[model samples]
Target: MEDPAQRRVDYGDRSFDEADLAACPLEQFQRWYSAAVDSGEPEPNAMTLATAGPDGPSARTVLLKGVDARGFVLYTNQRSRKARAIAHEPRVALLLVWHGTHRQVAVRGRAEVLPRAETEAYFASRPYGSRIGAWASEQSEPIASAAGLHEREAQLRRRFPDTGSPGDVPAPPHWGGYLVRAVEVEFWQGRTSRLHDRLVLLSRDGSPAALDDGAAWRLERRQP
Candidate 1:
């Protein structure tokens, strides 16, 4: 009872010339990301984050707060399940898909917790209610009920009335950011006749210099 129309689109027969790609993977990513934004894709910043846990591997969607040559940045509660997984195993992978363009980007990297000061600065930039929620909720922990959460939030609001300024909102110690340093970045483009194009950029020693060398990324075609 499956609908053929609902099946996942298979990207095949796409033509990709490695030479057409930018010398730097970051530049290429930026180009594709900009295209996605221009296409008016909803929540273009949404990416699937994969993390390894004690039990196994898990994946979840999170908004990308920032990106740079070093890695992609995302903010979350330190005590969340994904944060705990990252704490144990810093390695991670991210997947971004823009169905309209039939393009996908996969990134494998190592995650690192940003400095407390940086986390504080970002937290302070958020709305006062969000800051209070950070202090009120014990993320990933089982809650008695939604009412209980509301009560805790109400107490926090009463304890710290917003003064209409960033100074009035303090960062909770449990909230921070994580940066993923990519070692492998793969770009996939869909094509006709099930012939897809895949280009992979992998660093030999997890160093940025490897990407600079022409021989660093071993491009190959994958079966659709």
Candidate 2:
């Protein structure tokens, strides 16, 4: 087996300072996100969501579907482990890694389920097959076989055949979205010798606030 420790690459020296940051983390994130996209980074919106419940801490990668002053948004089956964990404990964390840009963002926040209207709206925008799959698969549940899953999906497709209209299939009741209201947001930029630059924005009151509320936030530089 190859020795994983033998592999190494120096992260080019890049500095991200307060002077380069936007007044708000969301805006800064948007700037970085745009840069990442322009650099041809694949799946730039992919983020790791971490949740804690009675059992323990759990983390999974979920695609960021929306973002704005409200916070980062993602969709999933409400009955899934992550959803259940959120139900047990709304406090959660998120990590967005953009390897191509040698940058990452970390967020500590609370997850709130988006309203049904918003969830349905986003669900309707998904691919036709994805809508059917949402109905066919019971997220987080054990399945007998891959064939069985495919068969269930096939059955759903027949029941709700695509009619060239997105409304042909509706989002399942268990499927919805969550908004992560970030109280603390940290932006990291890799640098040479692991002396990374870390800048964090924290809510003045230690509570979640809109990303545009610059007056209610404080920015701090942290040791890498």
Candidate 3:
């Protein structure tokens, strides 16, 4: 049975047209993404990342740190549950919804750990506190209490004293980023009636491409 607290409603924001869509999924994604950000949607870059473990599927909200023709990139603790799952099964799914704009994007792709150089570059850009936090968190592991967690963070702080040293904290061995190269991407937009618009772009050679190579993608519209 459905939960009593669950709610359902029809979308009625705007219509979408295939004629107006970009030939490449990356370009189309950029167009909608820019609009979402410019329109001041809350957490415009937030996305739900889903992975499959031995037991079942798990999902969590993650921030989208970078995106380009190659695919979408996000950082996380390499020891986190999601990372563990991805280690066994590299395929993952991502979803992003913009409530105010009544739009959402879904991505199906395979994930690969970013190169050490890329991870280090991003880690270096992090604020001091965030860099320390990465080292302190044993993500998805049990902790005795909040105090215990704080203690570990304090220990990291002392070891890596933010002495304003030119010595930037290095990216921990257990921390890094992943690039999800999309096999398929779908975009949905709300319409006046219950019949909304759904468009999908699929890769031909099953390889990631940059913005300029977007022409290799095939486009199609799906019935809502």
Considering every candidate listed, which one attains the maximal TM-score? Answer: 2
Rank by lDDT (best first) = 2, 3, 1
lDDT of 2 by residue, 90-140 (tens): 999999999889999999999999999999999889999999989988989
> Which residue pairs collide in model 3, if any?
none
Ten-residue segment with the worst summed lDDT in candidate 2?
Answer: 6-15
When 1 and 3 are scored with TM-score, the better candidate is 3
Error of 3 at 92 (Å): 0.7
Question: What TM-score goes with each of the models?
Answer: 0.87, 0.98, 0.92
Number of the top-ranking candidate, with lDDT as the measure = 2
What's the CA error at residue 63 for candidate 2, in Å? 0.4
The runs of at least 3 residues in candidate 2 whose Cα sits more than 4 Å from the true structure, single-residue gaps closed, are: none
Instruction: Give the Cα error of residue 224 in candidate 3, in Å.
Output: 2.0
Total clashes, candidate 2? 0
Off by over 4 Å in 3: 1-10, 206-212
Which regions of candidate 1 are displaced past 4 Å? Answer: 1-15, 206-220
